[model samples]
Every structure is written in structure tokens, then in C-alpha cells.
Target: MRSRLLRTARCLGRDYTKPSAQALRCSGARWQSTSGREWSTPLAKTLAEAISVTGPLPVAAYMRQCLTSDLGGYYTSHNEGRDVFGQKGDFITSPEISQVFGELVGLWVVAEWMAQGRKSEGVYLMEVGPGRGTLMDDMLRTIRNFPALASSLEAVYLVEASPSLREAQHKLLCGDKPIEEIDIGHQSYSKYADNLKVIWTEDVRFVARDPAKTPFIIAHEFFDALPIHIFQSVPPSQPSAPSEITTPTGKHTLNETARLPRASQTNSWRELLVSPTPPYSNHASLGTPKSQQSSGPPPEFELTVAKASTPHSLYLPETSQRYKALKNSDHAVIEISPESQAYAADFAVRIGGGTAPTPTPSLAATSSSTTTTTTQARPVSSSKPEPVHKPTPSGAALILDYGPPSTIPTNSLRGIKQHRMVSPLSEPGLVDLSADVDFMSLAETAINASEGVEVHGPVEQALFLNAMGIKERAAQLVKRALDRERGASLEKSEGERRKEDLTETVKRIETGWKRLVDRGPQGMGKLYQVMAIVPHVPPKEGEKRRRPVGFGGDIVV
Candidate 1:
């Protein structure tokens, strides 16, 4: 942690020695606009109108609108109605890349279940952001191999917000079974297991946390999509220009001017906000460096520092000591995601026994899980004594995403369009927007949220996958393909074609899995990370703590 703080301090010292003069100039005024029609997307116009009326939008507000707004957000049914995941989509996920990823994840869940004494009943499988249901499908198919774990499963719960994606998931997981609208969101039964019910909800809170049901939750590539607020530590005000110094003795006055005493105030945190870029703007106009500019017209929006302290800048940074340590550092930037913290806290409370906490002020408007809880209150009537039943902490939440292991994420927001990086501000709903996850923040939140839960890893995806036996799995898959090719030999010409097809299949399998564990500069293994939150039962005397598989522990079974 100390090292992380030092790294951040060095980053701040290198990048931001002085307040950005251009950013300060852009504050408190509307950018020069020629006409509303000049805006690229419909949502862009809407945002411009709102900004014109209210003021500049915080980066978080801008991101939420761009990514989840009902008016054609990136994830919603926009004009083109495009997919957000897969080879054709803006970005491809681990499951879409290789089945081994989800298979290993399923095994990890089973390993944890067995290690935790294997609850026979009241076991639930839940996945947040179940994109196309591919990961869940792969997981379920793999879990079915372990009959004991599979039979103990109660139902599958999917926490998804996009209706279009939900429909896609339904088609993939429940095929042909008409979805019935329920009080929460929607419900259907799985095609894989007829008896296993599947429920879809717009929010995770709708899926009530039952202390009785042990939940194994999966959150892959989820936290990075959540909105984040960026704050910059600006040094206290300085003089407008070189000024004549006034002294009581007039000796230090006139041509012999001495430097003025700097203000007594320390550096203050200010939020960076989103505002419309000037009409006909370019990278140079917005002070965007050539390296940061994307290949397109200038972005419709640009970031500017707020003139005064915003609610988020005041509260979010102060919540963590990691942020507090660098508060006085000049021009240090930090990105905080309250919604991410809220979700982490919720996952912790669900796995362990704890009272559900109200969402943080920054998250109240964003999250629906506020006030939802697994713990229930018992009515008392001053009569017979009420029997107390404390449910033992069980279950685990696995989170895999991309971010720094221990340091706060800084300047990590990005945009993707057609698998190419783009300016996040260029397209309102057309481009995918994401930011780096603060793994340390998540671990801190989960630990603080529930006494019964403990966090681990956030190790690199390479280390985790290697620990989970991805290499062995890939070898088995390749061998199976070769065996199948040999067994299905046909006529001379057909056999040659079949051999080519088999070769391609083998190559795809090998490359796909290798891509997952690739250690290149932009490889998934190096960029992504895996973390787990599991029930923590204090070891008695010299007893050892339980560590889940892929996070340093071996399979119990």
C-alpha cells in the first residue's frame, strides 16, 4: 500500500506539476457552438441541451448517460441495434474467446463449495452482467459434470439491465421458452436443466438474498463498466501574474520586488466535468495531445475541471485513506466509483451475514440495491423468547476485471468502437465506454461491509489462469480435436478437406486459449485481473485459513 501511494505520488509529480490553464479557462461557460444539428448523436444533442440548462455534467453523469441512458445508450437498443460483445462487437470477452475460461470458473465455484463443506440444498448460482449468457452457459455445462454440485443448485439468477441483452440471454439459455414477466423483472426455466429455474432482474437487489440459499456469484468484466468520478488535486490559488510586492519598509518595493508569500491553504480536490467542445473543435483546440487524439473528428464533448468543489469530490476521495494520503499532492488525479463500491459491499453482505447498508450519497441515485438485504428483522411481542438462528457464512463472489492490483486507477477511462480505441467523448451512445476497476477499493469495501467476508487475489489474469490449469485444459482440448479428426476420416478428397478443417479448429483452440494467457503489452492476461470475496471463519488456535482455488488454494475434492 505504501508503495502504491509512492507510485501515485511519482505519477502526480511527473504528469501534473501545475494546474491546467486551458482546463481552468474552459470552466463556467458554454463552448462555442454553431448549431445544435452539428452534434453527432441524438444523445449528444440531449446532453448539450441539459448542460446548457443546468451546467457542466460531471464525468460520472456523462458516463452513465453514454453507457446506460434509456435514450439509445451504448448498451441499450440504439438506432443501429448493435451487439456490445464478441468478435463483431466493439469488444470481445474471455468467455467468447475461449470456453476454458468459464469452465475453469465453474470448477473454481465447485472447489469453493466443496471446501466450504458443500451445502446440499439452498444453493444458488448468480451472475451479474451475464453477456449473451455465454459464460453462464459454459459454467452450467461444466458444473453439470459434477453431479453433486449440479444437483444442489436451486435456480440461476441473472442481473442485467439491458432488455435487448436479456432477450438474447433468454434465447441462448432458455431457448423457445417464453419469458413471463414477474414482479422483479422476468423469469424462465433453463433449457440445459428443465427443473432448474432461471430468473432475470433489472437489478441485483430484486433477487432477494436468502440467508438460507448459499450463492456463488460471478462478476466478469462488470466493474469496469460502472461509472467513475475523476478528481484532480489542484494547488491553492497563485497570483495572476508577476506583481509588485508591498512592504512596510518600502525597501523591498518597486524594481526590487520579492516573491509573494504563497497562500496558507493546501491543495484541494476538484472534480473534472464533461462539457460540450467548441464547435469545429480539434485536438489542438481542446489541448488534447496528438497521442491521445483518436482517428475521427474532434469529440463532441471535452473534460474541464470544475470551478468549485462538487459533492463527489468532497465525499468520494475522503472515504478511503489511500486517497487521503495524496490529497495534498499537486495535480494528483484519482478516479472513484461509488457504484462499484456499493456493489462490492452488497456482494459481501449477501455472502456473509450483515445488515444491508444504504447506498452512498454518490450511489443512491444510481443503484437500486439501496436498503435491500439478506438479513431480516424478527417481530417481538414481549411474550415467549424468540429462538435465534444465525446462518453460518457461506458462498463466494468471484470478480474478474482489468485494473491495477493495489493502486487507485488514474486516467484509465477509454472508448471502444469496432474493436478500435476511440475518444470517449466522440460518440455519446455509439461508442463503448469503460474505466479501470479499483481492485483495492473493492477489497476495502467488501471487508468493511461484512465481518464474515474476506477478500483475496486481484492477481494478474495470467497468474490466476495458470494456477487454474489453463495450459492443461488447452492441451486436452487440442488432443480431443486431433482424436476426433482421426476417427472421422472419410474419402480421399473429403479427408483432405476435413484435415484442413481439423487443423484450423486445432489452431483456433490453441490460439484462443493462448490469447487468454498472453503476456504481451496489451494482452488480456497482463491487463485483466481476478479477485474473490469468500466467507471468512476465523481459524481457531493454529488452524489455517481457507484459500479458494485460482487464488492460491488447491481443489479440496
Candidate 2:
């Protein structure tokens, strides 16, 4: 099958095909190539070169190339709406799974905008890596209910790098609304450029804004996509200690051959057997004729053996000199997200009016005159002044990803193909490679970036959604279903059984949802955590400020 696919690809590459109708429509006159060969196009040649230099790229890179590559980019040749979403796409996200998710997010954004003084004509409803615009569609639909807030939307910024996905977003958003394209000056689109309002980049790293402005940012399952560096711990070593040697008594020594006493009836000790020395020297040797026994202790001795020790000791050896030689024996996995940290810091800085540069002062000469008489004065040297560290603007940044507050016992880095977990490192980019986000490290970075921005949650998604009213929504949905069933009006017995079944089904769903949200030994409640950074505000004289919604007062780290 592999060979067949390769042959087909080679054949397609060699054949001269005309540009598709979609490409011609999008590019206009630029589509006219005198050579009439699509494979010979510069983009195609570049893609071929890339493939030649590097073996099959990682799935992530492949997706990037398919969407953004200059030559034969998927967006140029396909209808974005038709290719993604529905039941035809690679996968469906939570936004596509339900409208409730996006509606809640819309509400969250409106609240954030209000908290930030609500001065601007509109806020940037930016969606990073919006897949097929499903989330945006739902969010916009929800926003329409609040005309005042909806109209405040200065622009809908779809900060997507994938051209295919971007086109889909464009179709979904660029109708009667004012839409501007923010070009990042590369094949990979990262930012949205509008007229002097604000710029939304691919990630927080490129957000061009002032911290005081307090632009509301919303990212759904965004941070989890970032690559994670994984490391494993080394194994421990076994301990070594010196012991005295001894030999069995009543056994033949040199020339004497005699049967020794049975040790616990296991067998007759007829021959001399060397062993480690006993801790207590209590056993006496029975002398025999012609036996030349020396006064010096035997080289070895033995003691009754006990049961084996726990396997944990072998795997986790202590960090002592006795096990120094075997220090590298034990191991555990560790994942680091340096890129995520740097990106977060950059986002914080950019939002806070671009990171201020440290200022350097020039030395100047100063002279003073003597009080009593006229005298020559010399220039005085002064030490350089230390630059001031300005505090970052107060605002909250929430990050939702798949990870825990501490290192997991088992490595969580995994891949999903057709919704099945596959070996993470098996197929390079062909499969998704992700590790659980270390919430503790992320909180530290957020706190370090600005004083007001405090970390929150790192709670389970189930808990978060429930706190945000998912349970209520589910109940409403079930109620509607039950009402529809009643409206059907079946036979008396049938209706009763159906009603009972519906009740049981609703109960089961509620239980499942609860299990999903609450912390359990085997459930998503404990598996997925949500972390948020809220701006710190001083409490009133006797009234405590309300904690951020969806988060308890306690911080994770």
C-alpha cells in the first residue's frame, strides 16, 4: 500500500495539470502560467525541495505546509468551508461539539471588557487557531443577543497561521462586518492588521498593545497545542558493603573428610562450604582426626536467608555514597515548556505597552569651589544609577491546557489519531505530540511577568464548566428532550416505560458529567486542569473582593 501511494504521488508530480478553478478565481490573472504545467510552478518546486531535504515532515508541519506553503497551499485550491468542519474534517473540537462552550466564552469576554473600563469603541474578539470558525460562529451568535456588547466589537481578529483555516474564518466573519487582514510578512500568517485600533498576532508573543489598555484575550484549547520538551529521570544504583567471610563447621578441612550436621534438615553438610562471616561468632567447629584446622577465621560464612526486599528499593536507590556508582540507574520523565514561558512573558510585556528598555546614563564632570580660598577644582566621578523596574499593567491571562500541577507518575505525552491515543514519538509530525502542561511552572511565569496578574484554578475542566453552568445547560437540554417525548403522546404503557427510560438516561448523563468534572481516580476531572491569571485588586475596608469566576480563592501554586 505504501509503495502504491508513493507511485501515485510520483505520477501526479510528473503529470502536467492545469490550475484548479478555485485557484484561478482566488488569484485572478496571476493564475495564468504560459507553461501550462502546475508542477513546474515555483511553489511546487519549493515544496519538492523541502520534501527532498527533509523526510516526511511532522504532522504539525505538514498541516502548516498544507495551509501556508507558497506553492500548492491547500487554501488556494480548496473551499475552506467545505474542507473543514461538518463530519469531513480531521477532527472536531469542543466548540463544534456544542454551542454552549462558545457562548460562555462570549460572556466571559464581555465581562473582561467591562472590567477593563469599557472605553474603546469595541474589543478585539480574537480567536487564535480557530478551527473552521465553529467557535466564532457560536460566540458571535451568542454575542448578538447583547446588542450593546456585540456592537462594541471593534473587529473579529482570527489569528490563524493556517491559510486553509483562515479562509474558512474569513468566509464565516467577513460579511457585513469590517474585517482587516494582519499580514505577518511570511507564508505563515500570524497577525491581524487593522486600522490603528490594535493588532492580534498568532500567539500572545506578538500581541501589539499597551498594558493599560487591558485588551481582553480568549484562547480555547490553545496553549496545549504548543510543543513540550520531555525528559526522563535516571535510575538509582545498588548499595555495596563489606562483610567478614566464614566456613561451615564439621566439614572436611584440608585432609579430614567428615559428614557435617544437617542444617535444618535441608541436606547433609558433608563438604566444607565458604560463606560470609556471621554477625555473632557463636558456632564452634567440631575438630576431627587428621583435620588440619587453622586458628584464623574462615574466609567466608553464611546466615539464614530472609525474604527478598521490595522492588521499590531497587528502582529508587537512595542518593548516598554507597550507591554513587549506580546513580544513573533510576529514571522519571520531566517535561519543560521554555517556549511557552517566553511566549507568555512576551505577551505580558506587549500587553503592558511593550517591554520598557533599560536606560543607560552618561557620566558628566562636576566642580565645586572651596569656602575659604580660590582653588582649582577637579571633576568628580559618580557611580552609574540602576534602572528602575516598572510594574506591568494589571490584567488577567487564563491558560487552559491538558496537564497537572505536579509531575505525573506516568508520562502523559501522547498522540491521537482518529481519536485514539497513539505512541507520541512514533510518527514525528504525522501524529500530535503533547505532554501535560505543568500548571505550577506556568503560574510562576505569569506572576513573574506582572504583580497584579495572579494565578488561579488549574482546576479540572469538568469543575470549571460546571462552575460556569454546564450542569444547568445539560438539565435544560434534558428537560427539552423530555418535553418532546411527552409531546409525542404514545400508548399509556409505552409512554410510562419511555418516561422511565428517559429519566434513567438523564440520571446516567448527570452521573457521567459529574464523574467527568469531579476529581476521581480515573476520570477527566483529575486529568485536565484549568489555570487562570487574574489581576490582583486590593480588598475594601471590610468587604473582600469577589474571586474570579470559575475559580476558587485558593491559588494552585
Candidate 3:
């Protein structure tokens, strides 16, 4: 059944074995010769050459190369010192929009820590995709206010891949402090906290999981950036063959008769791959919308259905029941991100104990008693040691990103360049690519990966923030600004200028927070969502389970 489903699915529209001359021409037309064409970027040319040599590339492969390829990847490229964040870059993030966003996030972490018994030691703060380190810096500053919780923090871990972004984060989090090479990536002391060491690793897996410690993980707008494999369901074609037939005159003659598609045939999933558009293809040829067409140029790459079943098309969509349910629908399209699921699983395993091996062998083999410390340049760093036994699960992870609350993401791939939305296939490495996250898949993976974890609230960002008290926080900041203005003394004209400046300052603050919690059609609050994973508790017969603060329940401690 599996073989029949996958094999027939790949032959949709036409047979793969014996293609007619017209089919061959159509194939050639789709991916024209690159001889006379000039690509916009070096990476685009490289991608074209590679695709020419080796059939079309998977969307995941294209995204991975465009995003993190060593030479010209959007994030990894040091050429021209590309900046992918902030108003000057492709797009801005929540933390960059307002300080209140980060402050509330920090407060949520502290509140959770206190609710979960406030362990005196063995607590770590980790952030994945810590762009510019602005969120972490804001979070650390807020956490410092709670002496008990702040002192319990042993270390800070930042999972980042880009060298330029890492340096930017280092400069922001740890002013002029020297950063030294560590076994995993690099380590530096954060300027925001007292002797708090910050470690940067390219991947989260590099950090050894010690069930003894509690890790508060933050992934803000991270999952959306992960590469996604897109698949579409189409009616499968029946196998065809040239069968012999007898002529009407009773003479034996050869006839090309194909088998009819069976009524039992159902739609099957086919993976979409990325290939260079036909040479000099215009906006009309590419079928780009008039509203999306820019003065620049038509997209260089386009998504094409694979001619035959690829490994991903055969395997990925079948991995989940959610995808399986939609496989029979001819128009169903789904985007799956294995990287995002893996990261979510890792988060679950770290917070709620797991049996998975350490990412590195040497680290795995290191005895539980083994420990290491940073260089003696500054205050003593936290001791991170592998554990032999899985301790009681504790800690929490907060994921905030844009997507539907409980559905699989479809047709959500998009590109942003200088704030305007563009075709994702336009310019390789030059434009930023992102897709809506599959929150349901993430929750499923997290729960399946760890026995000690429970999931909560794939809720709207507005609901979460309102519950977290964004309005109250914004109000306090406004009051403080007004008080400062009232205490100022100057000449009449000077006072007038100061008053106007203060009024604008107050207005900006109000606007920023409102933008975050706004529920309008284009607002961030409605578009984005928040999810949390924490240690699970066995329910007693008569008592209700405790809920996290931002989700529904109040802080216990």
C-alpha cells in the first residue's frame, strides 16, 4: 500500500517512464538554460548551477542554504556585515518594538520560578535565536530586581549561529568584556548582572543536559525562521502500459492502451522543490500577483512539484496523524519543520527529564562528577557537569511566534526586504524568508519527547500579554516619565521644548505597548501566539492541577 501510494503520487499529470515530446518541452521550459541569464547574487548563481547539475532542490534545502550557508547565507554571511534585524534590516522583533515586552517576559520567568518552589541553586537562563541580545539584556535587568531569583541563576546560554549576530549580541550584553573561546562556542560575562557568565553555542544540543539544573528557555520568533518542507496532496495516477490489441478486422495489431484510474484511488502527498525560473522570466511568466510585483525583478526561483517521490515526500507527511488526516484531500497543502520539532523536543527534554544521549560523545561519556569552570579573568563561572541520574524534572520554556493557534500552517512562506513583503524566491540570501509555525505539531512533539512534561495555552499573544499585565506596566512607565518632566526647571522657551519632548516620549511609549497588545487585523498580538512547557504533575483524585501564571492561574509564591 505504501509503495503504491507513493509511486502513483509521483506520476501525477503524466507518466514518468515514457514522456512525450511535449512533456519534455514543458519540462525544459520550466527550468530553462542559465547560459544567457545573470543572477542577482552569487548565491543565486551557485544555487542555479547546483540545481542544474542535480535536479530541483527541496524547499528545506534551499531555505537552509539561503539562511545559514557558510559563504553567502542570510544569517552566516559576514560579507558587507549584513544586519537582518531592526528597522534598518529586513524586519523588527517584539523586543525591539518595546521594552515592556521583554520586561513582562522576564517577570513571567521569575513568577514561574517562584511558583515552582524557587530552588536555591541549579537554575540557568537560556535564549534561542537571541537577536542583538536586546531581549536577554532587558530580561536580565528585570530579573536582577528579584535578588533571590537572580542569585539562583548559575549561567546564561545563548544559542546563535551567525558570527556577526553573535558579536553584536556580545557587544550589547557584555560591553567591553573580552570573550574567550570555549569548548562549545564562546563565553563572556554579561554586563547586566554581577559576574553572570554568558555562553554562546551555535546549536542548543551542544549544551549538556543535567537534570539537576532548571533551565528557563525563551524562543522569541525563533520557530518561524526554521526551514519548512512543503507538501501538496494530488490525485494519484494509475500505472500505464502499451498493451497488445486485436483490430476490428480480426487482425492482430499493437495498440497503446492505458489502464484507467481506479475508483479506489485517493490523493497522495507530493513534495514541492525549488528550481530556478525559466531564463529571463518576467512577472507575468512567473504568475506573480500585481500587488506583489516590484520595480526590481521577477523571482529567480519557483516551487515545482517533484516528478518522482523523494525521500521527504514519502516519509515526512506520514510521521504525524495530523498530516495523515489531510493526505486524502486533493487540495491540502502542509508545511512541516523537523528542525522546529527537534528544538521543541530538546526544550522538553531539558526541562522535563529525558533519556536522550548528550549531543557530543565525549560530553556524554564524561562522568557525572566531572565539572568545568571558565577562565579566571573575571568572577567565578557556573560549574556545568553531566549527571548520571535523571533528577526530578523542573523549569519552564516559553515560545512566542506568529502562526495559527492550533492548526498546521499552509501557504505561509513569505519574504521581507527592507520592511516590504516580497516573493520568497526573489533573491537568495539577500531577502529574509520565514513561514508560519505549526504550533500543534510543536506541542505534540514536546509531549511525545519527554514523559515529565505538560503543555499549555497555544493562546493568542494579546490574551497572554493582557494576563501578564502589559497595561499596568505601561501605565507605570508613563507616570514615571510625567513625574520626571514635572521636576524639571528651565527658561520659558527651554521648558516649552522639554515639555513637548516629554509629551512625545509619553506618546511613543504608549504607542509601542499598544502595538504589541493590539488585536486589529494587522496587529502583532492577534497574529502572534504564546505556548509554554513545564514539568508535569500527577493529578490527585480531588484537586485541580496548578496552572501557570500567564495561562490562567495566579502566582503561588
Candidate 4:
């Protein structure tokens, strides 16, 4: 039997950017080369070269290649030299649609900050997917009203994964600086920084800024853009089947295969996930199966999908919720991104209180400790936090995306080109490829990431926005409009005339607000969702649950 995987990276040749004929053959049928115009996309060529060298690529790998590839990745090439998120872009986010969205979010952060009594250590104001910085700008402007809260902010950070987006963010946030002078924060000025304080990076993994400072993270329409791995659940092997192979020399060899993908239900295509690693002898795969073995429960297997290059799957404990949670049908698919999970873990660690078991024991001990626990108790930042400390760095993260609370995404993967939906594989890096964020996994990751981390409602965007007071904000704007539109008409019916004059402006304001908060198809208020994680400090006497503002509202709207 041949080696299941030939481990052929070097066979690709000295130049990894260009695909070689020998490497193309190594990629098998999934990646084919052609000297035609169809293969003109720089991203496609590079991806082909990558696959040729690496063999079949995982869904996440393919997505990363297409989205962030330095050569011609869609986002890397600066949104493919096209506008990607406005009336003129591929799609528009809520922030770009209206200022109300940002204002409310800003207010929410303020409420949370004040509720915590303004940490002396302060907090890092951060936003994931800042987009042209419109959301953050609006948020900053709104927060500036509370000078103390604004002052409490140590710094602002933007978790951007695209070079093009980072450049755009600098231009949008830095105001009048020349492109040369404003290259992602070469110089740091505090005054100019109140507006341009945000630091940009192509990686979200390091955006926590400082582990010592609590992070007020706003992830609007962010997680959905992260890459996910697609997995197809394989049925249990037969009672007396030979899932393993034995060679003629009496040496047992395991079967190993690289990334594989298949078309599935509409808008979804299943990709290679964890497959059971067959018993192997030396370094070769034995095609012969040992069917004459004893009959017992078949060997169990778990997915090794976190990394793209994992050659075989292994048995996971029954406690593993991922593979266990897959639907009964063979068509059921589970998408997981190790990067997302890792991001969650890193965030959780920075967040201070992770769900790790030791914290619970520590908590039990703290409740019985001699020192007063004060308003809130937080875990120390270091691996070994000082024994008696109060106000552990509490961080709160709000994730907003067009994803449901559910983990299983049957067909959430697709492409959007100029607002028109297109096949994900159609143009490769030419289009933006995204899938719904698995908030369930994210929540779990948060819980498992660190001690003291708590998860909150993965509520509807409509409810979240409404709770944030979009309606009140809209009304105030309308009232302002009425004043601006009211002319010097003096008759008794002048009031009616003024009202009539203001109707269009009120309607305009209402329309944009509706688009942000409405539950219907045209509105993003429902399809999009909001979830948050913060330190769970037990409420004091008369205090109720301490959820973020987006989870509930005092106002009817």
C-alpha cells in the first residue's frame, strides 16, 4: 500500500508562490491547473499553488488564503480594490446605516463602566471589525459626554484582520494626517489620539492590549467573518469490519488523508474533518483489512479539525460536545474554527475569570477568607495572582453578527458581491466569503477559556438595539428636525404646516431607525444578534442580575 499522505511540501519547488506541475499533480482532483482565463484571479493561482504544495486544504485554510493571502487575498488587497461595506460597497453594516446604532452601543458601554464604579485600572475600549471606523467614531463621540468615563478609557484598540481595512481605519480615524505620517500609529499623540487613539492589527489574537486592563470589547458584525471548519459525521463502523489494514510483511499500517470537500445542501459544502487514524506499521498504509478479528464495540474516533494539516482523527472523550452534538442524519455538518476558539480562550484569559475548575475552588476559599470581598472580586491577572485582591480585571465583550443562537449552520456559508449573493467558490478572493458565527461554540469557549468568565444572552439584534434606545434617539432626532424645519409661519394652522413640513424628515429618521431595529427581512434588527461576556459579580442587596445594557432595557423601546 502507498503512503496515505506523501508529505510533499518541498516537492512544490523553491518558489512557493507559483504552482508547479509536479505540485499540481500532488493536489489530486480537488485542485487542477489550467492555462485558461478562468484561472486568472491572483488569489486563485496562489491558492492552487498552496494546495499543490500542501495537498487538500481545510475550509478555514482555504478561507484564510482567499481572504488574507498577501498576494491577492480579497481583504489583503484592500477589499480587492473595491468598496466592500456601504451603499457603494458589497454590503453595509448597522453602524454605516445610522448613527443611532453606534450611540446606543456607546451608551451601553458607559452604563456598564459606571455600574462597575469606573475601574481605577481603567479599561481598553476595543471594537472588532471597526470597518471605516464609523462605529467607533460614533461610539467615541457619544462617550465623550461623560468626561470621567471617557477619561477612564486607557486606550482604544481595533481588531482588524485586513491590511486594507487597517489603512482605511487610519485615514478615517486619524483625520488630516498624510498617509505616510499615519501608517497604523507610528507616532502617538494623546490629543489627536482621542479621535485617532485606536491601534490596528491584522490579527485579533493579540488585541486584548494589556492583560492588566479590563477590555470593553465591541464585536459588531465581527465573528461571522472568521473562518470555520466544516465536519461531516461518519457512522460507527460495523461490528466485524476491518477499518484497519495490514500489509503482506505482517506490518500494520494506518490510512491517512488530507483535506477533502464535498457539495452538500444549498449554500453549504461539507469538507474533510477528523477521520479515524488506522493502525499503521512503519510509515506506510496497509490496504489490507483485518476482518477476522474479535467482535466488540468498534473503535471510537474524534475530529482533529483544529489544525488544517492533521492527517487523521482520533477518539475523543464522551464529554466532547462537538461531535456528539451533530444531527442524526449523515447530512448533518458541524463547523468549528480553532482560531475562533483560541481567540475566545485568549480573550477569556484577558477577561480574568475563566470557567476553569480551579477558580470555583478559589472562589469557595475566597468567600471564607478574612479580607472583605468588597464590591466585586476578580482573579489576579498573573498565573499566580496575589492571594488577596479586589476588582479583578473585569472585561466585557459584545459580539454582534448575522448569526442565530444555534451552532449548526446548514447553509450559512456564501459570498456577497456588490450586494448580490454569489457562490462561495465562484471567484475565490474576488468576493467576500463569510459564514454565520457559531455563538454556541463561542459561548462555550468563553466559559472554558478562563475562571470567572460569564456568558450572557445571545439575544436578537432587534431586541438588543431596541434595548439600547434607538427609538428614543430617533425621536430626539425627529424633534430636532422639527425645530430645524419650523419656519416663521405665524397663522394658527402654522403648527400643522410645520408638522407637515417635518413629516418627511421624521419619516426619513424613522426609516433608518427601522432598518436598524426592525425584525423583518429588510431590517437587520432580528437576523443579526448580540451576545456578551463579563465578570459575574454576585449582585449586592436589592441588586438584580448584572447583565449588560443590550440584554434588557428600562425604556419600553
Q: Can you write out model 1's per-residue Cα lDDT over 100-205, one digit (the tens) per residue?
A: 9999999889899999998889899999888899999899999999888888998999988676788889999899988897766679988878888899865665
- Models ranked on TM-score: 1, 3, 4, 2
Q: State the TM-score for model 2.
A: 0.54
What C-alpha lDDT values do all the predictions have?
Answer: 0.76, 0.44, 0.77, 0.57
- Stretches of model 2 off by over 4 angstroms after superposition: 1-91, 114-122, 175-206, 233-330, 350-395, 408-410, 427-429, 477-524, 553-557
Which regions of candidate 3 are displaced past 4 Å?
Answer: 1-34, 239-264, 283-290, 293-297, 356-391
- Candidate 3 lDDT over 58-120, as tens digits, reads 777677667765435677666554577888888998899889999999999999999889988
Q: Considering summed lDDT, which 10 consecutive residues are worst modelled in model 3? A: 366-375
- What candidate 1 gets wrong by more than 4 Å, as runs, is 1-37, 78-81, 239-264, 284-296, 358-390
Clashing pairs in 1: none
TM-score for predicted model 4 compared with the true structure: 0.70
TM-scores for the candidates:
0.85, 0.54, 0.84, 0.70
Task: Provide the lowest-lDDT 10-residue window in model 1.
Answer: 369-378
**Model 2 lDDT-worst window of ten:** 363-372
Candidate 1 colliding pairs, count: 0
User: Can you write out model 4's per-residue Cα lDDT over 100-138, one digit (the tens) per residue?
Assistant: 888888888877777666775557787766887888878
